[model samples]
Target: MPTALPHLPTSRLLLRALQMDQAEVLYRLANGPKIADNTANIPSPYTLQTAQDFITGIAEKYRAGEVLNLGMHVQATGELIGMVSLRLNARHHAGHLGGWVAAHARNQGYAAEAASAVMDFGFATLGLQRVGSQCFGRNKASARVMQKIGLHYEGCLREAFFKNGVYEDLLTFASVRSDWERAL
Candidate 1:
């Protein structure tokens, strides 16, 4: 199991562990309909307590080799712009990637940049054989991010996700280590 979450720096962003001090910022930026509507795990009414708890558990999960959740920040301004995560399945040498950008920072390629760094970490550092991601079919922005990060589209699972009182189709995407390396 990995002992620590390393800080990942991209050209425009820094990916690091979420800190307790940033709970308020996390709550302020994430507690909105736009973010919650697109993600499955984030609750509709994101609270400060939710942010604290999530941060509090990150270390333990990382120690267990189960999850890696990093806060995405702009390197120039040091602003908390979003988050990206890789949930591991060690037995299968695979991982599931997840992420979102703050509404204010959309369409700027930050999500793809940060996600690409994490995928590189997963495959190169963590020795993952494959990494996958899924988004609500309606989330074209997220799907684009997945593609931009080199994950090939898998298949859609019809009505596989139930969110906000409705069942929505889930679009899956993935890439094996060889394919990812070849694309680089």
Candidate 2:
């Protein structure tokens, strides 16, 4: 199974797959407490080697039809602002959404714009029945991003995420295919 990922161009950003040359940028921007603390997969003290490894693994994962990881870039400057992903669950026909924006790029709605594109891809291209996302409860901005993209708050998983040192609540939101179609 090929990645089937698309090059999504929005008004301000270009969403595409991770490139090998971006290891340094991914490290410089994503290797911090701000990003690492919130996401489930990104680890703090992120290293060039780790970024390189992830870049190399993208093709294989895409071929396996399990993951579609996209790097969000500024079209005019080509600077990487963030990343977004859709982790597919084949049996369930569902996709789990994840994303982040660089600290400097925050508050400008870049993450939300890219997320909306991914959600559209998950439902229209991947044929996922539902697309779900979550944020650590303390992160109101992330939760708002999910809500802005039309995901309804489902419930919270108490102490579900153990990052830094202690557990934090996880707020889940989801949007179904029918809802997406109806909106469009």
Candidate 3:
């Protein structure tokens, strides 16, 4: 795995490494009920310190070939819109995909576009054999993005995720290297 993070370009977005300067923007975009409720990891009261720590940790993770978390930025306006990530399991040559688009950026296809770019990097650049994603069962938009990216629906894991003091069903989706290649 390479130490340097990648810059993935889509038609309307630039997916790049998060910078320290963008911590505040990340905090603002992520510090909301809508985002926290849907995601497994992000806390509801997301603070600036959390964003800072994440940005700081991502570099080390990248260097260790453990993860890649890219900020989604609009190419035209250079505005930070969201984030996409791939957490690698080198032993299995697979990766777990995770991401979120800001409330203002939802329903615009940004999630699918950015996610596709990262999946491309994972298979083509990092030699990953499989990439998978899971979303809360209620997040229909996220499921759409997974399908749009050519990930086949696997199944639902009932009460697999614990978030916000409740159990939530998780819908899984995935694409192996062969399927991903055929899609391209």
Candidate 4:
């Protein structure tokens, strides 16, 4: 099945597919120490060239239909402040949701708001049976976003995430379509 490109909205944000021109802004967000610590794939010193490479990879991934990576933009300023994604594995018909807001944009409910938009797209439009998220044990902010969006608190997998030369627990959270509907 061909997946549609879904553009979602919140009161002040628009979560749409990533564009090549968004590299510079994304570079700044991904390079932040706090943002890198919360994610497994983004390196610590995310450079402009690294962001360019990321944009290239995302372009390729979009063509392949392996993931739907969206840029979180402020509607008022027309700036790319972060990203939210719905990643699908074609073989299993299962997907994962993830997101990050720039350091300057934290504590304003942007992440949770953008994530809620993606969750609505996943369940209401895409017809996904189950969508979930994971966070590093130390990432309380991300965990809170999950809860704020109504995802259930699933158990942690002890020592499951090996990062920065040490093993850290990973907390898994999920929300089904029913749960999402109830929250609405």
Q: Kindly list the per-residue Cα lDDT of model 1 for residues 1-184, writing each as its tens digit.
A: 5698789999999999989999999999898548999988998689889999999999899889899999999999999999899999999999999988898898999999999999999999999999999999999999999998899999999999989789999999999999988987
TM-score for all models, in order of appearance: 0.97, 0.96, 0.97, 0.91
- C-alpha RMSD in Å of predicted model 2 compared with the true structure: 1.2
> Candidate 4 — what's its lDDT?
0.82
Model 4 error, position 57 (Å): 3.6
Residue lDDT tens for model 3, 49-157: 9999999998899888788999999999989999999999999999999999998888899999999999999999999999999999999989999999999999999
> Candidate 4 at residue 49, lDDT?
88
Q: Which ranges in model 2 have alpha carbons more than 4 Å from their true place?
A: 1-4
Stretches of model 1 off by over 4 angstroms after superposition? none
Sequence-dependent TM-score of model 2:
0.96
Mark the 10 consecutive residues where model 1 has the least summed lDDT.
31-40
Model 1, residue 164: distance off in Å is 1.4
Tens-digit per-residue lDDT, 50-149, candidate 2:
8999888876786787888899999999999889998889899898999899898999999999999989988888788999998999999999999999
lDDT of each: 0.93, 0.89, 0.93, 0.82
Full-model lDDT, candidate 2? 0.89
Which parts of model 3 have CA positions greater than 4 angstroms off?
none
